[model samples]
Structure formats: C-alpha cells, structure tokens
Target: MTGSPTHEPWEVYALKYTRNDKPRRMDVMLGEGGSTDPMPMDYFIWVLCRGSRTVLVDLGFHAQVAARRNRVLLRTPLEALATMDLHPANIDDIVITHLHFDHAGGIDQFPDTPIHLQASEMAFATGACMAMPAIGGFYEEDDVKELVRKLFRGQLTLHEGDDVLEPGLSVHWIGGHTGGTQVIRVWTRRGWLVLASDASHYFVNVLQRRPFMWTYNVGDHLLGFERLLALADSTDHLIPGHDPLVMEQYPPPCADLQGIVARLDADPLFSVHDRIPVQAGR
Candidate 1:
C-alpha cells in the first residue's frame, strides 16, 4: 500500500514530575507583584516529530536526584514518558535549553541520543560561579559529569549561535536564563510554535516584559525576551518554559491521565489572536 510521505507532527507533552516548595511568586520574575497564587513549577518534556527522527526538548528531573537532594518528585520522569508510549531509546535527538538540573538531569536516561546544547552552557556550569556557595547548590555534579562524558565521546552537538536543525525547525541562541540558553522555533500546524524554554519561565514574564534573575547578564535576559517575543507571530504562539496554565489550556491527553501532546501536523484549535484571560493581580 503506497501512502503519502510520512511527515509526522511535533508533539509536546508536559512531563510534570514535581511542584515547587513555594508557589514561585510570579511578580519576582515579572518585576511586578500583581499575581497572587504562588505558581507551581510544572516541568515538561516536549517530544517533536516522529518516525526514526524524534527530538526531545528538555528531559525533566530524575527521581533519584530529587530524593537525594531532599527535593520532591511529584511524578517520575520515566513514568511521564511512558504516558506517551515512549522510552528513552525512542528519542533520536535531545535539545537542552540550558544546563539547569531540572532540565538536564534526565540526559543519563537516554544514553544513546545525541544532545544539542549551546557551547557556553558548559563553560558557565563549570566556571567560577560553581564555587560560589549561593548558586553552587543549583548545579548537579552527576548531570554535569554525564554531559562531559558525552561531550568527550562526541555525542553532543554544541552550537555557538542560531542554527537550523531542519527545514521547519531552528534554535535561537538566547543567553539570559543561562550563559547559553536557547529557544526552539518550529513550524507546526498551529502556525509557529516558539518553545521559550526558560527564556521566559512564565507567560507573565513575557507579558510584563520582565526577566527572571537567574542570568549571567540582565541585559541579555531582557534582549532574549524581546527576541523571542518578536519571533513569535503572536503571544499565544510562544510557549513558556514552566507555565501551569498550559496544561489547562491545551486538550488533555488522548487518555485522561496524560497531558495533551501538541501535534505539528494538525491545525491548532486556538490561535495567538485568542485572548487568554490574565489572572487578577495580587
């Protein structure tokens, strides 16, 4: 049976493993205090494309690391992928937004996949800041070790600047959240989807035109936000790195237990023009 070329859609799923201890005060990140409820850290793992070339964006936190660090894992990362009938081996390429433990810890789970990371991220993680007691706590030794091993083995693809991975997909180097943070832009049925992974942690971060402070250069953070917002056709087309409201807006998974996986080939039910009501300011 001769069928059309197998062009699969890009599917993004929220692999939420845990919530933050205190609802992260939205205003602190937005430079405004209008938001009341402390926002939960709803982590995610975005799966893109299909067939023999599946790309994964951010590999949620590892359960063991969370426990060892005395942090909570509301859900296991592996179990979250299982919801989509996927295993680590199923992934072909992994795009890491930054070297943060929450987003990079799961690389060990997918040993064979080639990882795409910005070159500067490696430098920042192992550089002078690591010695500082305040921010040192955020770096995961094991995760860095594994990534180093992969780098030496030539399993990691390090990009220095903006790069195109495919015809419809590209990576924009936005150094803010980290020295080498990046956001993924994909042309999907929903028009254009810009995964502002950590570039903008929450929707308000973009709306208020404020930036999170976990950055090397505050100026770069501001510029990155503007760059991402411009790349997006509209506000709705830009997906924040850790927004709880995302789960609420998108359709639930095919089954009730899983979050909806966005399909690149299918037209989005919603659009950037659609106005999502803003939560009342605190």
Candidate 2:
C-alpha cells in the first residue's frame, strides 16, 4: 500500500464513518422522478497511502453533528483510520471535495495539516449563496469558520482549478452538488480511479445520467458525470460518494474489515450496474 515516485499506484481505502438507514429512493434519485424503494446511504472518507505519504479525502462529520443531523455515526473518521494504522499525525494533507458538513467537519481534528480545497468552493460557502438557508443548510457554520481559521493560520491550500497534490494524486473542480465541488483522481493498481465525492452520490447517478437531489448547478453536475467517466480508467473505476453498494461491490482489505472499509485498488466482487458476481480482473 506504499508508493514511491516510480511506483505511483497508490492503495486507496474507503472508510465508512456514518450511515443513514432509510433514505428514500426518491430522495437519492431526484431527477429520475421518485421511487419508494429503500436506499440507505453511507458516508465515507478516503485514504490514499504511498511511501511515507498519506492523503485523506473529505473529513467525516463530527459525532455531535451526526447526532444533530440524525445520522448514525458508526465511528469517528480518526477511529476508522486507526483500524488501518493511520493517525492524524500520519496524514500528510487532506483534499476536501467540498465544504459540506459531512465532508469538512473533521478539519479541526488535524489543525496543523495543510488542507487542500477548491477556491470556488471556499467562495461559494462564504458568499451570498450561503445567505439562503436552503443552500447554506448543507454547510455547517463551525466547519466554515474552522476553514476560515485555517486560511488565516496559513494551513489551507486553495486551488483555482485542477491541481495535483503529488505525482499520482490530484483534484479536479466540477461544481454540481455545491458551488465548488470537486472529485479526486488517483492512479491506482487498477489504473486511474475517480473518487466521485458528491459529484455522483451513487453509481446510478452517473451511470443512469440522473443528478443527485441536492445540487448547486444541475448543468455542471450533469457534465461532471462525463468528466468522471473520462477521468477513470473505466466505468467500474469510478466510486460514488455515498452509495452503500460500494461496501457490497468491493471486498474489504481483509476479512475482519468487511463492510467497514473497502479496498478501492482491487477489482470489485460484483458489477455495479448488474450486481452480479464477476470474475477476477473483469
């Protein structure tokens, strides 16, 4: 799971930190009309490990925030990382896909680490758009204020567009769910994988061309689907942000971690589209 300059294929882990037991199908697939089927949601924070380097994507929300929002807080993001032997001190940097509470709430846990974010996202979270409760409700004031503090403390790295964190890891701005939402692209053993954090909340969102329920700009969100496909090595390489199916599709790093964390660098056990078992390396 470690990488060097030449060995750029990093090991990516999707750590599930929170869960929503009963998200209506209609709520998740808003553009495709609505359905009464039950579709649960899982919140995640990703970990990318290389030689002496570890990058985290999207810090999970705090326990209190989860309780306030009525989400099932499985565990803290730090606790999830500890299962993989990663700690706040070991995180080199963090890539915040957006400033939503679920994604940016844990910034305070790593006060000294440099957090990378999209410039537009920062502006959007702090701009006039936030004055509207509907738009601002997704973002937590504490998280935004913490980010502002990070800016003043010189621990934030704001990127205007697509930016590289290193040789194999990068972030691309693709606004849809929020003003400056972005996705993470990483070179993995399976090839390029797009961590579609909120860009596509579920595989069906992109695979079926349906936008998620919450969005800042529908056009950008729709375009982001194509962008994600292009960024990934293949359709299966694109991982959705909140789909519980991710746990079912991809195998865990080990037997003990089943349903808790998924090893993204490995081939999935089932096809995301059909949910059928697939041969290895398919």
Candidate 3:
C-alpha cells in the first residue's frame, strides 16, 4: 500500500472486498444459470500513488447503502485509505467508473478531492434510465445527491471523452457495463495496466466472451475487452472488476496487508492455482 516519495510512476493496489451474504450464479450472468447455483464474487477499489499524489478508482458504498442491499460492508472507503496511511480528504483524485451505487456510494468521504467521471455516465444516471425501476435500483439517490453536492462546489471534473489525468494515469471510456463506465490505465513497474471496473466482472467474461447479464450495451461490453487488452501490459495485466482470483494472482503488497491490499503493479505469480474453475461445455 506504500507509494514512492521519489515520485516514481504510480503503483496500483486493488483494495480487497467481498459480500457478507449468500452467492448466486443467476445474479452473475444473463439468462444462463439457475438461481440455486453458487457464484462467488470479490469487490475491489483501486488505489494509485505517484509521488505525493494518491488516487482512488472507486469509492464503494457505505454502511447505509450496504444495509439496503444486505451486503457486508467490510470496510469504508476512508478505512481503506487509512490502511495506506492516507486520509480521505488528502486523496488527490477520485475516478468513478460509473454512477452505480456500489461504486459511487462513498462520495461523502472525500468531498474536496477532484472526482473524475465520464460525462455520459452522469447524464445517464439522471436521464431517461431513471424511469426504469429495474435500471434505477442500481443507483442509490443519496450517493447521487452527494455527487451533485460536490459538483456545485466545483470539485467534480466530468470528462467528455478519454482524457489523461497525468503522465502515467489515464481513463478510457468503455461503455459496456454502463454508458459512462470507464476503466483506468496506469503505467507501473511491470508496464501498463488496465483496471476493468465492471467492464469485465470476471476474467472469464473477457476470456470466454461472456457479458455480464446487466450490461447496457452488449456491443460495447464485448469491445471493452479488446480496449482493455490494448491498454494492458499483458493478459494478466488487466484486472477484472470482481474476481476473487485477483487476490490469488496478485499477492498483497506486504504480509500485513494480506487479503486487504493487492499490489497490482507488481509482477503476478503466474500459477494455475489462481485460476477459477470454468464450467465444462460452454
């Protein structure tokens, strides 16, 4: 979780998380599985550091939102930063991949940090999609209100399209999971890495061309894989949004941070032991 005082290119870590409730394969895919099957998932919010700048990719939901969904809130966004000796108010930037409640719910934590997001995402979150109860349920109004509050304070930076935040960190608009769902690309010690935020919830989603059931645009969802691949140093360089295998593939930054922090920029241990089992006969 430590960054360089020497101002080296950013090192990225995927702060670990998981639900406190039961799992369901039906929830993971679209029209493919029975609700009775088990589908384990992991959640992550990336932390990036370069010199004095520390960036958070997503601010996961808080206790209130967690309570509504019956999800286990293992740690708040502020707590995640505290692990790295960082205070929420000191975060240099916050890049929200989309406006989904799970990812954007913790906006109340870092009010002053510049929040980056694709304009399309914001538009859609408040647009016609709001009329659809099914689609609207993904967003918690309190989270959106917090963002609007920040926007009025001039703390929000909405990206019209792909843009660079700096030399080594950039965001690409990948409209699959959501219209404004963008992923982060960072230059690290290993090379370039792409953090696919719900762009590819599971590695199998990209490796096997399976899109998450709740995607907005099917084409964009599928193309996101190629775009992510293009930015990644290698196949392993691209991190899936909610795959437990991420922990196994990339070890924690330190022994003390085991299961709490994963150093993504570091070389991953290429072992089959990290791979999740793919069901037979697709």
- Top-TM-score candidate index: 2
Stretch of 10 with least lDDT, candidate 2: 273-282
> Each candidate: what lDDT?
0.73, 0.87, 0.80
- Greater lDDT among 1 and 3 belongs to 3
- How much is 248 displaced in model 1, in angstroms? 1.0
- The total of clashing pairs for model 1 equals 4
Candidate 1 minimal-lDDT segment of 10 residues: 1-10
User: Who is ahead in TM-score, 1 or 2?
Assistant: 2
Task: Name the runs in model 1 displaced over 4 angstroms.
Answer: 1-9, 24-27, 33-36, 258-282
Worst 10 residues of 3 by lDDT: 1-10
lDDT of 1 by residue, 1-282 (tens): 112223444555555556664655544563566566665767777777644667888877787778887788766777776777888888888999888888888777888889998888888888998887666667788888999999988999888888988766778899877778899987665556788988888776766666775666778888787788677766777788877666655665565554434333344456423544443322
Error of 1 at 204 (Å): 0.4
Q: Whose TM-score is higher: candidate 2's or candidate 3's?
A: 2
lDDT of 2 at 27: 58
Candidate 2 lDDT, tens digit per residue, 1-282?
223246558999999987887848655665555776777789999999888889999998898988898777888988999989889999999999998889998788898899999999999998998889899988999999999999999999999989888898888999989989989989888888899999989777888778887888988898888788888877788899999999988889999999899999999887775862322210
Score candidate 1 by lDDT.
0.73
What is the TM-score of each predicted model, taking all chains together?
0.86, 0.93, 0.90
* Model 2 ranges with Cα > 4 A deviation: 1-6, 25-27, 276-282
Better of 1 and 2 by lDDT: 2
Query: How well does candidate 2 score on lDDT at residue 61?
Result: 89
- Model 3, 86-138: lDDT tens digits are 78866888999998887897787776788999999998988888778788889
Clashing pairs in 2: 3-51
